[model samples]
Target: MTKKDDIVQGEGTKSGGLSRRGFLGATALAGIGGATGLGSLVMTRESFAAAAEEARNNYVVHPGELDEYYGFWSGGHSGEVRVMGVPSMRELMRIPVFNVDSATGWGITNESKDVLGHDNTFLNGDAHHPHVSMTDGRYDGKYLFINDKANTRVARIRLDIMKCDKITTVPNVQAIHGLRLQKVPKTNYVFCNAEYVIPHPNEGSDMENMENHFTMFNAIDAETMEVAFQVIVDGNLDNTDADYTGRYACSTCYNSEKALDLAGTMRNDRDWAVVFHIERIEKAVKDGSYKTIGDSKVPVLDGRKGSDFTRYIPVPKNPHGLNTSPDGKYFMAAGKLSPTVTIIAIDKLDDLFAGNLNEERDVVVGEPELGLGPLHTTFDGRGNAYTTLFIDSQVAKWNIEDAIRHYNGEQVDYLRQKLDVHYQPGHNHASLTESRDADGKWLVVLSKFSKDRFLPVGPLHPENDQLIDISGEEMKLVHDGPTFAEPHDCILVRRDQIQTKKIYERDDPFFASAREQAEKDGITLEADNKVIRDGNKVRVYMTSIAPQFMLTEFKVKQGDEVTVYVTNLDTIEDVTHGFCMVNHGVSMEISPQQTASVTFTADKPGVHWYYCNWFCHALHMEMVGRMLVEKA
Candidate 1:
């Protein structure tokens, strides 16, 4: 096995022979094989800072230190949500959501265009699956949500000022992809997953009737971001999961031959994994039995084929990640073109939704082949199960009840260690592996092509993530990093379950509509500075503190409609402050006791310069301010 480990385990199969499906079509064109021993399993040099200070699964922080976990990434297509820190992966904060941020003027603030939708009018976004927001199944540091597979939308954020407060737009879905929440009574649902299959009145009258194209399974309203019912199901939802007695949830439904291309979605060798049954889709949405399509008033129901709240099951090739298993007993399902990982048995999903199981693959109970391209799975609360594979760039680590005692034939080996990851890994997460407190330390992976690992930065390649340690019994690779844009997925949380907030408490329902329009124009954003014109519409009102900006100058006029607002007044929690109006692309961010707004329209008359882009102290470029404008 050492001809560069047979070209990194596959030049279309050799080492152990037989992989079939033409070795996944030679692992979908597996080229780029480099293996410089994945840089000796990431030990950078000099005993890699003494094996990261004798490993406690620490990634080392220093400089006023702090970071025991908080990750929450997704930022894919950079629609934004970053916030890292776990085992020192650093990155700290991004949030923006559905694009347009320029330092913090998220979509150029008017309180983020009243939460990105006074007609969101698209600024570009993609952000896939971020999560966080759970309760009895853990992590509840308030909210996180995410997912905007480029505008099928679903924002949320607000885990105590991490920002993004609410976006919604899930009407009948189109590519909301897969999102998850509701792990028991507390989360009250967020679900999601619409991934293509249009024409339900998508207006174009079923062009050639692609099986009347479908897609739906939404469910928002984890505190009113609305749309609380959708279901529809049958295939074409990608990755989603939930289980901990909130009556189930789970997705993975590859093209199920709704066929549109890519060889008619691999013409099924089995493609399913639905599940659903959240109290019978909430008693078929409180007995209205469900319908309403175009002009979505939510309630869709009909969990496809024999629905009474779905079951589907099938699964093999084409199923792509639908995890679960954190001692809530199993739901695995990877198998993107098969290497296997079915698993199933969450107490046999109440005996396969009570039709007394016996097939629906008998609520699955383990399939296990695990290799080649098993797409995604994670969990470690001791019964293992890492699984990333993606055409064998590796991360297997098996063992769920010894792969159900080797699928019940009991010769039990369950393949444990695979490691390698550097090229094409698509999602692998561990710490708190999907709730029930799954603390198996750390394990990130992500990959999806980082070409030569780092420092080429040209043909667009910066996604290597890595970071392992999986708390012993082997799986080391501790930290490789790189990441940018294609963040696609990430979640760790446990900086004592993230309780954040050292400032911004004053009237904060996140700037409570800019403190209810500065209490209807009498303006007292804590000692307001004042401007307030109101005809061509002005309203200035500044404040700050570090290195000034309590007005300093503010005029308006030329085609008015200004706005401004500011208000940091430094309560000293990292004294934040930033306003940037220069050449008017208008910026924002005023943290401390916070209050922000932005408007922008003096339509360019003169003396713009507003400054203070967040630095905060020692005359930080003299914080500055000017805005004048008058000349209409």
Candidate 2:
């Protein structure tokens, strides 16, 4: 089937808009047949692309509002949600809520109606301490589904009224983390991962085994809120108890008592799973030097799938967030507690069922050398993929098309070498929403987790535990303003598009004069600014102001080559800055008082933020400027 056809099948629509069929396609099955035969499992590349295309059309690509950008804040003690406005990075709104244990994850259901006077879910409950990992899906744009860590229940929230409709408890589920809505035929189902669950030896025994049976996928019905199918992921089991005990012990076994302490005590003597690196344990076994003793090696119990769960895979850690590309051609999974993201060709899904999946087919993406942690991920319009970092509190943007192009040997490097890395400390779970500027260019917004530091008040407080700026090469600290105490999530809002005739007829004659003066001064134009209309075009000049930091802005018209001279100005604080236009295809960094120049034609016009690229400097928050580009 063609991509267009797949859209019809997956989204259940002929027109490129939301329909009952589109809702079904997004929530129900892509086609009628189930995964019964080998032919059904083996999907050709063309068919997969079609399915992805159909899924893409269901979403309405609205222009983003600069003022409606939603962000979450958690200051060690309390938490609130804040909306940031454009033109100026000011806080537009703040909804304060007290006693929030920890804001794990959040999602905006497209219900359009208000719930609890709010559309977002805080993911807190009575029995559980409100640990929500991730949330997704808006069936008929009314119901919001979230996975709760503390309760292991999938909370179905009514978005129109903004109230908790019902919480469906997943039986035998423990430490549930990520929740995703997968559309089957007629009904929409939820696929979730039960990260870890404690299994007792007999009944009320003190000993607990960190069982692998917890990692299973569940299919849920959206309308009725019922579970359709439950599938356990078990790869292979080769070695006997001795080999597994010595090799995979760290990955599997954990003291149930210790887990309770960290997570806080639970009601039912339930055992909590311990977190560890499984790949390291496997290496020790392969070398034949794995230590086996009463304490060294724990007994391996048969999981739900028998030995399938205990099998070893090339990827070294526990997989956390799992998602498919918009095109459904690739499946991506991240290793929990480790900084690696793995991409698997979906065509290989059948291998898992055949018991012949190869570890070499998986490509692991990581920057272990740089201490970056890859956590939750979401896709944007231009086929680019963005992943969040739990440890560093930053976002990494990867070019999926380029990665695939390089994988296909089309080019040695497929990415434009232009990376727009943004820094938002404590940035944990994130989602993407696209919007267009008055000029019709696409922009993406990122939500982050910003919280206040929890300081120890005793005399024994470590002096070495001071705050350090380490944003690294890709991202610079832009604004350290007190706008946020703890930002947990963010969503991009597109502003309404401005007509061409209205832009030229605006009352601001100063903007037009600035363009004429810059040209009369014998300055060559480079590009137009997106947020500002000082003039149609401005002259490019270079200056050296700060060491390893660049200070620059733009001037532009409807159509003209604009030049921006960037200089490194030496400021009072130790900070580095760089300039980049991700969509316009321009960027460079300069040293303090040093200068660099880049020229690019303003082919695409939109509002984009250019900020500092280095992690140094205390007032790093003050390093932000905007550009507004008009049509030529």
Candidate 3:
């Protein structure tokens, strides 16, 4: 018997009601010369450029800014979670992930109970951190989908109740690092990126037979709780082909020996004969890079053949996060290895699949201004996009519609400029929400690290410190208190209430103070924030409502050493409170009923929130608050 027949018989080829040798030969033929043929048919750059220009000429202005919300929720190392409020850019809330002990100030209480419940329950050896989160406004406007990487499970959280419910386990997968939800009118599919798998050590001896596999895609039926389809991007092709009465060839090396072995055994079977040699040719072509060919070489099943999949667009490296545009016209993917955001036109997917074999359809956004390292990104209601810069500990914004217009040939240099950069060093995941306070104006809530922390700059600049500042043209700092500890993941608490206010009414105090300081420093404070209409400035304060009692409010003119006084008014025992200003870099813990004061300098204006580091607070989900700072 030939080498292929020997291996097939050794593995009991027909025991499972399938002929292994026949299947391997067929697959080899289908994959040969497939990708190369696809690549040669793509549109040239000049054609794409002309098409882009034509698209702009026919473009019609949108009536109003897009009205969809984007959220970023990250897990923390110390069990603290935070969400960023986009556009306005502020902290929505910070909640504890574990319960703390009152006596020893060590050992969290009920360590298994996550703030969101069963869905967020701590695994056998797991701890709370902002691991993964998703949002589906259709299910419920105030609900968020989250996954605990440590536990390898998915769950749902209700923003209104701050509670979580465990969902079904994502089937046929392990180590889900990133996931995307595709809504197909009547059906919704969740595509999960599974763990990387290397070939078994023993397979190296038979390099031609060794297999390295990654879960290409898994289709889950949300309604039936069934795994509808599973595709292995890389696998032992013989296993699949055998069942189909086809032949497959080794993908590791291009040679006739492997092909001849299978062909000799399956020659008597017409179905097997057609499959074996065909697959061998395909495999030779794919593995050899089409450098050499023989008479046995045959065409393979390439999606790009005779299609428009030839166009190439750049995609970020190690894409771990993904989201689609509100209008479903665009899709965005975030890279983990490098700082890069890729935008893809969804309408082109079919064309991409048709001819662009080995080509990725995507465009790089904000490449020139900021170094790429985006971990997660979400869209705000006003056509702007927000992304978290993991390495920089900062959040960046982009105008999607403006970006598309630029990609499609519109020229707007200012829109191309990167306007806002909020530096919250050591920051992780974040989310955005739009709500109205008592004043009847839209408020952006951002959640982030509330501890006195610092990230290393590098060996050369070891002392370089970073802090997230939420102050900008369309952003401001509002309120703050002790409600977080190494805080990470957060999402906006969306509500239906609407409120409107005169813009200047919110800017007078900060503008006036900034103007005074700028004049003293021999600099001019720009006539911004409508200073004349409402007054010269605005008053901004933060209130904390957990672990103890405190309402910290102060004017920007007071300098950075703002004092916060705490009183123990609640009946709860052993409950202590503390406040830490991240940007100012100072913290103090206050005991119950006794007024204690802490002071820190606010050198920069941005959104900062505090959380209770004490135990037994994660269950309440009330250990944090919001603070907004402006140019003072």
Once fitted onto the true fold, the runs of candidate 3 whose alpha carbons sit more than 4 angstroms away are: 1-143, 157-163, 170-172, 180-190, 198-210, 216-229, 234-314, 335-340, 354-369, 391-393, 405-411, 414-473, 477-488, 496-632
TM-score of each: 0.38, 0.40, 0.40
lDDT, residue 263, candidate 3: 48
Root-mean-square deviation (CA) per prediction: 19.1, 26.5, 25.2
Can you write out model 2's per-residue Cα lDDT over 1-632, one digit (the tens) per residue? 43423332211222445454333332222222232121242233344345334433433234563432222222211333343443234554333222231111011211111221233344443221111111221113344455555455565544322224445555544554445444222124444545554342224554344442234434455666665444333321110101111111101212222233544422222221111122332343355533222231321222332233333234324333344444444445544445655555545434543457454333232212112455545454445555555454334445566566555655333221111122332222222221111111122223232233225444332111111111121111122233222233333332221111211112222123333544566543223222223364444553333222233445456465565555454543333356555566455443333333444566666666655555435655556555566665
Q: Local distance difference test, per candidate?
A: 0.79, 0.36, 0.34
Task: For model 2, give the 10-residue run with minimal summed lDDT.
Answer: 236-245
Task: Compute the lDDT of residue 459 as modeled in candidate 1.
Answer: 79
Indicate the residue-level lDDT of 208 in model 3: 51
Could you tell me the lDDT of residue 376 within candidate 1? 86
- Please provide, for model 3 over 149-180, each residue's C-alpha lDDT reduced to its tens digit, 9 standing for 90 to 100: 44444444434423332244544344433433
lDDT of 2: 0.36
Candidate 3 is scored at a TM of: 0.40
